[model samples]
Target chain A: MKVFLKLALFYGIINVFIEESLFNYPEYFPKTKYDFSKNNLSKTKIELGRMLFYDPILSIDSTISCESCHSPYNAFSHTDHRLSHGINDKIGKRNAPPLFNLAWKSSFMRDGAVNHLDMQSLVPITDSLEMGNSLDNLLYKLKKNQKYITMFYEAFGDSTINLDRVLKSISQFELTLISKNSKYDRFRLGEDHFSDQEIRGYELFKKNCSNCHKEPMFTNYKFENNFLDINQVLLDSGRFSITKNSDDFMSFEVPSLRNLSYTYPYMHDGRFSNLFEVLKHYSGPKFNSVSLTEKETIDIISFLLTLNDKEFILNPENKFPVNKLLK
Target chain B: MSNKFEKFAATCGFFFKYFISFLFIFFTYNLFPQENIEFQATFNNEATKLNKNYSIRKYHFNIKKLKFYVSNISYYNRKNDEIFTDEKVYLVDLNNPKSLKIKSQINKKSQLYSFDLGLDSVINVSGSLGGALDPIEGMYWAWQSGYINFKIEWESNMCSNDNNQFIFHLGGYKKPYYNKRTVLVKKRHIHRLIFNLNKFLKKINCDRQMIMSPSLKGENISNLIVKSFEFKK
Candidate 1:
């Protein structure tokens, strides 16, 4: 009896170690691009990250964390607004993108301005129209909060606030925002069946859009000239602005189609309100590139609807950590 | 009553033994040295020389910040023999070559030291903003995906009709634009790989200061810099 108890205790310890080190995602998804080896996730870090995500301490007026624009209910994206609004109702240049499965993205922002996930938050926190707060000032503010001090200590093994710890904590939380248990995922797992319409849509998507919006994760992770006409006022040149290459003129990073239900106001500019508008744009003469076919367009739209993962948006664990924040 | 007391004593003794063993193991792990080393690069302009004719400027470039990961850095001497191996952090000052410092954060761990040298396994070449942060400064180009790795830029006021700006952004990572080459330095007895910046400038044949950014082409003259350096003792 004593031997059995000893064996069980050993097993429990080993299991805990394994669980802490590994993140479990659906097998269909490709390997994550975000280097977890640099940040390394922990329970404490995730909790601290969640708190920071909801806290407005990151902004100048203390009105925005990452969650202000990218809310969980809307699949971590802003709703209705074409351009993202920040502190003092300042309008940003681009749309607030939906945040999910970021571990797979090699680059961030619609333009891929930032290369590493760790440095992505700095752009928003420092952008004049966005948070309008410096890293040093934000650190000073976080230092005053006793709860944050303790939380930071627990997450990073040191309470003395720094940009590295702050960014890492937020990254830890964002990395956990993995959305994979969609209807499509269930069908892939052999545990559930897709409706005839969804199945037909999936076939159409593979033929028309699968080259760019590849399956499993639904993104080729490449920049493409989707043939979007230059908006007259914005005149945004997309990837060309970053690279200064004529070839990259108007090419934008291909966004993931997952959670399309909640993350409406689609595209880099957020010009389209619903899926139908986006489909209409694709069906127009401008998008009549050699790449897409008319029949394939409708089927792709059907497959996009199936990409919505209801369980992810409603997950209580990912919601505003009200109790922790209140404390 | 005596038998029950003895059984309780045995259980208590067993618990104490396991607890002591666990403490020993924990302490042993914590006692070891675990120090992390980091590298930083610095750039400096020594002599700011401005031209009278076209208002073109020249500056002597020096290392501004020297940062690197020396934990896995290996050094090979002239004879290609391994001399030293351990975790060490080094900060190299390009202007003051002799002022090298080695400090130990953790006593039991290896000491971190830096050197002031131009070219080693890693070199810092400034041409593009993206190239400055690359592990190897060899890849510097705007058109291609990867770094050009090595190139030079120079400003000349003597070459053009109105003394127009001269620019030579060399080193191509792709074929057809391929300009990188290895030169054998017989004097140093080391295979000194020289990026022939002069050769590239000759090919372009326009002795004009080349501004790196396309937007700044006519407004400002581009200055390209290269340093002759090696690992020091």
Candidate 2:
């Protein structure tokens, strides 16, 4: 009986290790930029991160959370609102970009201000308009919570909670947000086929948008000027604000085109509510080369719809921890 | 013969005393092998204490805080050959007296020493770090990721704002605004690295009292910081 119990315990440990290494992505996806060696994926850590992502306790007044803006059903992006609403109903300057395929991203934020995914949560947590909590205060509150202390001990080896553990655990959950089961992915794998309109749209996309919004992952991960007219109210200069370089004026990160059906309104400011409106802006007088006919615009929209992954959006694993959080 | 014997005995006694003293020093040094590199912040050759009032050439100010990072400290020989390098980053703050002194295992044979005033690009981009490089230290910038190389805040009448405050946070890991400056001291025997702010304060442009981000001004101020270091034997 003693020998059997020891064997079972050893098997459980092996299972945990296997689960940590099981981060599945498509074969066509490029090598991830995130250094997984620093913060290895673990079941406990990912679960802890999911809870933290959904928890409003990260805020000063415990009123706002990451989920408040990034809803799981909407491909982890806020919908309808032109700008992100934070704590105290204070609106932010830029749109809340959807959270997916973060492992491949070299930088975070629309302005490319954050250098690493592990460090990205610090911004929203500390921003006055957003969570509005200082690091010291946040740590203090987490320390006081017995549930967090127990969860932290399970995730890490010890119960001692610090800024690094909190940030890294959140990153582990985000890294798992890979949208690789789209209709486009299936078509690439020869499991599905695209309609004639989608094929024509694919050709048009190859001709025009593929340079910045590349294939496989659907983004080249470069900051480019999309020539959107500056909002007189916001007067926001995108990447220029971070680098302080004149040439980088009004340039924002080229967002991944995956899960577009779930993630809208479009653009950095969420100015366009639909795909046709986004295409209209691209086909405007400023972008003469991208002048698409009305028929061509409709075809492109049809093709973009194929990129949406319902499997990813509705995945039970990606949703809030109902059992854990509620309990 | 007796007089000659007395002379020989006296000579042996003289050499024995010298030998005993040498043995004592060698063992004590080995017991305490850790060498220290002490950083001192001074205003006009006097130690600059936190929240202390300082006046120089019509500028009256009280230093609320002064903290900076010193990283990749290395020792060199007379021929400029690298001897030993301490691959640790230290947060030297005026408020923390113990943090200002960094201990290293450097030999006395080293003729020169050098260290970067800020963290290298590699560390700046590398995810979350603990200890001295921890974000909780208030040295790490959250909105835009990167460590603040040098931070100095003063309550001064020179500022035109409602609150009489002048602040400078200087750091940038990416080019062409990379602000980490290498400071080399030719004398390695002098462990005291003094930051004399007498010249730095006088050169401050009072009109632009606040500089919190990376820019041309941050780069220029970083250069001045490299020049501000004075060695005390």
Candidate 3:
């Protein structure tokens, strides 16, 4: 009986490893661009990352966590806020973009500044207007926490918490945030059917928006000049700030059209409060390349909403660990 | 348990002392007089360092920030065939004078070649990395997907805009605009590599000071910065 139990345990471990290796996407979805070979995923690492994501110990004063701005209820994007608020009610310059299906993103942020998801966590941690904490100090705090010490040991053998492990673990949790079960996804797989309006909208989307916002991922991952008149108070030049080239002036990363309903107020600055305003803005003279009628606008918005994955947001795996580590 | 830990710590302390002595002997394994390969990024001369007024391009200037990356520096044997050790990339923040001096390791008799100066395109796209390539260094572009191989910023009376600040953020990792550069020093066999910021600043026009992307103009600026490195006598 003891030998049988040991064999069962070994098989269980193997099953967990196999599940971690899977990208959790449909066959139609392209191969994930994330180089997971560097920081391979495991249940322990993902759990540790989830705890870190929810824990406020990463902040200078331990007042805010990654979940503060990126709440899971709103598709991992905070709702009803244009600009993100960090520690001490400090207002950030741009809106917090939704975090999901990150395995496909080659670059991150509205400005397309950060390339890899692993290093992406550092921006908010060190930003003076954001978390306002240093990496060295944050590591010291993590080392002090006994629970974190055990978690680190479990995830990355021997409990040494450095930049590589911290970033990689967080990435492991983030990579699991794959969203492939939307109404649109089911429609594509022939498991379900789209409404007539949604089908019409999809057609319009292919004709107009697909040039920039490509399929499957709904983004080409390139910076383009959207020609949004610069905000006077918070003057953001988009990608030009990073590149400083005049040609790249007023350019921003083409955001994914997925989960649009949950990720509103729209645009980089969160200017439009709703999809109607966004459609109206695009219909205006700013984007003269394509014009949409009132019915077409509604139809496209209807199709965009079909991309929302309720399962991705409400998944038990992605939620706060209230019953597990926190308790 | 407390009593046991205290006894264990005492034994550890005894071993630590012997470990230090052993390390001293291990480091001095070289029979001949040992030499160190040290590199320093210099500004002006010995009398002048950062935050102090200096003259370059025939104008008064004081650096507010100066950070750049040097990577894959390898030491070659006398035949220049075999490599001693691949030099890990290091970000030299010249503003803090202490960060200027970098001590390197090489085989005793081997002569060193020019260090691979900046991050290559491969290193930029390789996702998250550690040590000097760590994202916390502030050399990586905050928004874009590439590493900023070199960053030089200063305030000068010569500049007219940006509060008289001259800024150069040079990096890119893609076709046509590839930004990572390698500086090869073929001639001098020296123990020190000196980077004189004065030489770089001498060529800069205050009116055209700002460059944040990798372009033809940015490439010229980076090439000039690479030219600033000199081996000490």
Number of the top lDDT candidate? 2
Candidate 1, what DockQ? Answer: 0.06
Task: Rank all candidate structures by their lDDT, best first, as comma-separated numbers.
Answer: 2, 3, 1
Candidate 3 wrongly placed segments (more than 4 Å):
A1-22, A286-289, B1-36, B41-68, B74-87, B90-112, B136-181, B187-189, B196-225
Model 1 lDDT per residue over A1-327, tens place: 999999999987875675456457887789888766566667888888889989888899998778889999989999887888888999988889998999898777887766666657767887888899876688789889999989988877778676667777888888888899887898899988877767777876776678998888888989998888888888888998866778989999999889988887988888889887777776677755534455655566666777889999998989999998876
Task: Name the runs in model 2 displaced over 4 angstroms.
Answer: A1-21, B1-32, B159-163
**lDDT (Cα, tens digit) per residue for candidate 2, span A1-327:** 999999999987876676556587778889889988788788899999999999999999999989999998888999777788889999998889899999999999998999999889999999998999999999999999998999999999899999999999999899899889999999999999999999999999999999999998889999999998787899989999998788889999999999888788889999999998999889999997989999999889889999999999898988999998888
Name the candidate that leads on TM-score: 2
In candidate 1, position B165 carries an lDDT of 45
Each model's DockQ score:
0.06, 0.62, 0.43
Q: What part of the reference interface contacts, as a 0 to 1 fraction, does candidate 3 reproduce?
A: 0.65
Provide a comma-separated list of chain B TM-scores, one per candidate: 0.29, 0.83, 0.77
DockQ-wise, the better of 1 and 2 is 2
For DockQ, the strongest prediction is: 2
Q: Model 1 — TM-score against the truth? A: 0.64
> What DockQ does candidate 2 have relative to the true complex?
0.62
Interface RMSD of 1: 10.1
lDDT of 1 at B133: 33
Model 3 chain B worst lDDT window (10 residues): B30-39
Ordering by TM-score:
2, 3, 1
